[model samples]
Target chain A: MSRKKGFWRSSVWSLSLLAVLAGCGSNAASDSNGAAGGTATNAAGSDSEKEPVVLKLTTWNPISQTVVDKFQEKYPYITIEHDKVYDQFREIIRTRIVSKSDMDMLWLFPNQVAEFSKEDVLMDITGSPWLDNYLEAAVKLGTVDGKTYGVPYNSQPIVMFYNKTLFGELGLEIPQTWDELLAVSEQIKGSGTAPMVIGSKDGWATQFITTAQFGLYQHDNPDVFAQVASGEKKWTDPEFSTYFDGMKELADKGYLLENSVGLSYDQVAQVFKEGKAAMWPMGEWGYSENFDADFSAFELGAFPIPVNRGDQPLVTSLVSDNLLVGVSWSKHQEEIKLFMEFVADPEIAKIWSDETKQAVTVKGGTSETYSPLASSLQPLVDASEAQIFPSMTSSIEPVMFPIFQQILLKQDVDTSKLLEQLQAAQNKDI
Target chain B: MKFMNFRNYIMFILPALLIYLLFFAGPIFSGLYYGFTDWNGFSFKADWVGLENFREAFRDPLLLTALKNMLILSVVVIVLQHSFSILLAVLLDQKLKGIVWMRAVIFFPVILNTVVIGYVWSYMYAPMVGFLPKFFDAIGLHGLAALDWLGDPSLAIYAIALVMVWQYTGYSMMIYLAGLQSVSGEIYEAASIDGAGPWNKFWRVTLPLLIPSVIVNTVLSVIGCMKMFEHVFIMTQGGPANSTQTFGIMIYQYAFKTSQMGYGTAMAMILSVMILAVTYVQIKLLSRMEVAN
Candidate 1:
């Protein structure tokens, strides 16, 4: 009995020590990785004899692995390691950063620029030479407090994607106002086609419509949010009331797709691209991403969401999707900077543009099959008729997003109460 | 022998003690401590914010709604999932044609991964090309055709719950089957000799004997449904107007999306206490269900 107890005690101590050792061993491995990465990467600055370096990049979205290989070929010493973390990127990445994980770079949404830049987590790269290569608006998105913490990757806009062939067949012109848009939807429904194709099953998809209005009105009244903040203007006031009323009118008249709430985004896009729907309200990238020649023989065009303000320039909702950010305390800042410069290169930007069918923010980057409707998108930006949405009040969006879905679910919702909730949430965040 | 008894007990428990200290106790205590601080999930550090996060949570309409949802899921799953599972298990226990196949079919969904089940159900619940709407339409139920299973707030949570029931009913059934098998066949023979009907035999003999299974199933489902995340995360993501929001989803939303780590941890701590209290109450209440075999 004494021998057996002794053996068990010995085993317990040894096993626990082994677990401790295993944890320490992992830390040691990462330390070694950080060391190797630092030396070879910093050596790149002098452009002299160098050793192999690994640059770790974490992204929530897919970027072609081949693109990393291409970058490696250009800089033989630096090896690019990409980690694709989906669904739980925010949680995982925040934890990683806090635990001092040695990731060289990461992708971020535009709204995160301010959140991260406020901390020591993100390195300031305001002087990156490649910043000049991107459009001013795109560059502006990666800036917080006049400091550039990220480099712009891509921009997309929410718009009305209409089938040109179907429009011609129905003798319909692009609607200039909210009433016209609804009248056209009713007409399209009368002609036995789904009028407006949307998938409200995903609340985010429904918010595209709401977000579009938010953007359009911001272009007209930039102080609207400030007014609400000061309690001088309610959301039930003209700015939002008109938008909500127009939306409710559409729902009341059955101008929406018959089974919109049951369809997924991809499925509804498929229906619209196949010319089964008269108008598909989607992101500008929809034409490039969702249009399949096998499903339709029609040409597609785009227009902005009409705010029904006669003679006011129509505001298109534009948003910068991906911004490349670097860790502030990385030893290989030079190497991280080099990688960002390469990604901002028009050649690399063009490759991303061609693959994802999304617009690259780099000025010289161009895709072969760019839509003519998207061609004048720059002029709209210059005219101040383009608004970067979801960024207007990103602090409040987390609280308001669910309410947006609720408004869609119950059309008769009291807008005053909803605005009060918004006001309360905004105050709490403040 | 007396001298070695102390050593033997210590040796036996040391490994488990170490594991419990490192994994379970470490996280729970750390989370509880952080609940008093204002940690923004990431950054330099946290500051003390005692009782503030808890106060905020109590006032939060969304969190309250999520708590309500947790209770609804708990009650529905405990009652419906276990009773239905026991009934099916009893029927399957009888020697019938294709009994093995029926058991296999019922238990098959349990073995499949949550993601596969979630995605498959998501497609089935979809309209037009999906199965549910088509079946309803074929049956001449025009109103039921194209029912927005996951979209309408009034119906979305129940729809999600039905999927949960489908996935877990087999699990409870297997437990009941095991309990049913444990009962002596001689007892049934004795009941037959007493001139008892099938229903009477089941009620008087089988039910009392099956109390253990009922207790386990009820406890398991109550806790499982309270911690429900995967299917709800994949299917609706607590959407179609926050109708399907649960404490688990709220924790993720606050911790990650909103980046309020301290508050999220506080919410998690509150949720842990709630689960503990509920489970204890449940076990005590369900202990009355057990009968001496």
Candidate 2:
């Protein structure tokens, strides 16, 4: 009888706890509106009159945390809590957006910015005085339907990291053209180093390089994108054949790692860092480590990939480390503007650039004193002809990423098949 | 005399009946109702979609791949697992020394969480940087001869299946051991007096008595294998081109990832039908074997 009474008492307690939790949740939503309004009211105050407004930021780069900490010290009244989620960063941000939960600031890719900007979930920063400080291509990527959605910070373009030691042994200069690249591969193979360590396991690395190879069109033909977007030119055009044949040539010649199809980028990177390969095709993010690591003791040099017609020399890349800060449909306009002005500071960009060993997209933020690899990468930046938007963040991303994945798996994969799949996916949304 | 007491029997069964109705039957019937409507798991309203979600699931290639994986997994686990368990039980029943300790060792993997086991094995198969491949190299295998086990599509599913077999064989052994205990010692003694060989005695006497345990083990293994999710998910995430994906993974993709709750329910309904059909057939076959004996 006592045990039965105890069970009844425990059940009543659980029921009350559930009721209390439900009440707290509803109350918290109301409190959030008051808090956001209060923050807007106090934005113009002196350092002491302002209560600390702590905003939660989710970003990808490790260096962004350093940038946030420095920003916090300068403006003590505006505290920022930053967290980094590496693998599933996009998934977390997407979930929050769909749920209409809180997110004050976030980092976005070209595709993500394009998608969200279209959806009107971002603050329009275009025509602002600070917009003049950013690169034209970077600004264009952040703009969708005549409204700027994000402040572009850095850009990472695909470059070939060739072994200078192997080049010296084979008496070859760094390849200036695709023909020379293949020629150098044969020379390196004869000299006893693996020609290149291309890992296609995760599938994204292949897309980055292949997209770079196709960047020449943006400069040569301004109408190409408008045409492609309108579905005028097919993916099966002759240019695609050249790209597919080139990828197949590399695979057939065994220039890539034998187990690359089965290995991830991280594993392949270890092999490159360990000096088992002559060259690695990766972005500038790995530059600081390449220069500092004792194992990568050989001379490291980067060169812009050559176009088919070498004279045109068009270079393109996706925006890197872009911060897309927006007023939530729930936030007051004044609060978002103040936050945007704070993130746009040159000092913040400087601190971020120094820590991340990346270039700042803003004027007066690029530094020459960082390292040799960053200095040599100036041409790739200068050649920023275009930024091919990612499709996943937009209606197209879920469709495009998988189709591109199949293309990278084998060269024989038909381009027509991918185009058809995309057309079908677009029809579904319609 | 019995009719008056039978009134008391109704009182005895009433509490359990109420609990089952509340916990199991109520939710199951509710799920059937919700399965026909488009619900995102939250919201005061749900739109009815009729049989459209089910038709889409039937047409999806990913869902088809998942179904194939489930069938393959069920067959592999039910056959290989039962054979190994019975073999182990027979060896232990020979009255060997340290038999008590041996039984405990055999049952060790059965108690471990499948997620933990999957992760440990994946690291062990981590190709370039993993212990197994390094050990193989140390023992003198060179180049591509040292296989990348989990990364290769052809071998990835088998590696997961092998892990499942190792985990459940001990469980099946324990059930067989219990059944072995009930087989009269007098039958074995009588077989020996009739000059029956050891193999003959196992086939004629022991095998007949172990039939019931076989049925139980098969049903359990099949049901468990058909619902296999956590281990394969943690280890592979259906990589190397969706080679290890199961029906449960597909259901999760529709429900949470894609936010298609109604479609997920439709898939779950199909799964229920498949499980029921497969189980009914097995039980019927097992009963027929018992009747023949």
Top lDDT model: 1
| Candidate 2 lDDT, B182-276, residue by residue in tens | 99999999999999999998899888889999889888888777777777766666655566667776676555544456777888888888889
Docking class of 1: medium
Off by over 4 Å in 1: A1-41, A44-48, A64-67, A217-246, A270-276, A297-299, A370-384, A390-395, B1-16, B95-98
Summarize candidate 1's per-residue lDDT along B108-185 as a digit string, tens digits.
999999999988998888766568888999999878876788877777788888898999999999999999999999
Q: What is candidate 1's CA lDDT for residue A146?
A: 80
The residue pairs found clashing in candidate 2 are A391-A397, A392-A397
Write model 2 residue lDDT over A282-375, tens digit each, in one string: 7766566445555546776776654444565546454354655664443444445555565567666666677677777666676664446766
lDDT (CA) per prediction? 0.75, 0.66
- Residues A236-334 of candidate 1 have per-residue lDDT tens digits of 565565545555566667777765665667767766665667787777767666766454467767777775456666677776767898876566677
Residue pairs whose backbone atoms clash in candidate 1: none
> Where does the lowest 10-residue lDDT sum fall in candidate 2 chain A?
A389-398
User: What does candidate 2 score on TM?
Assistant: 0.79
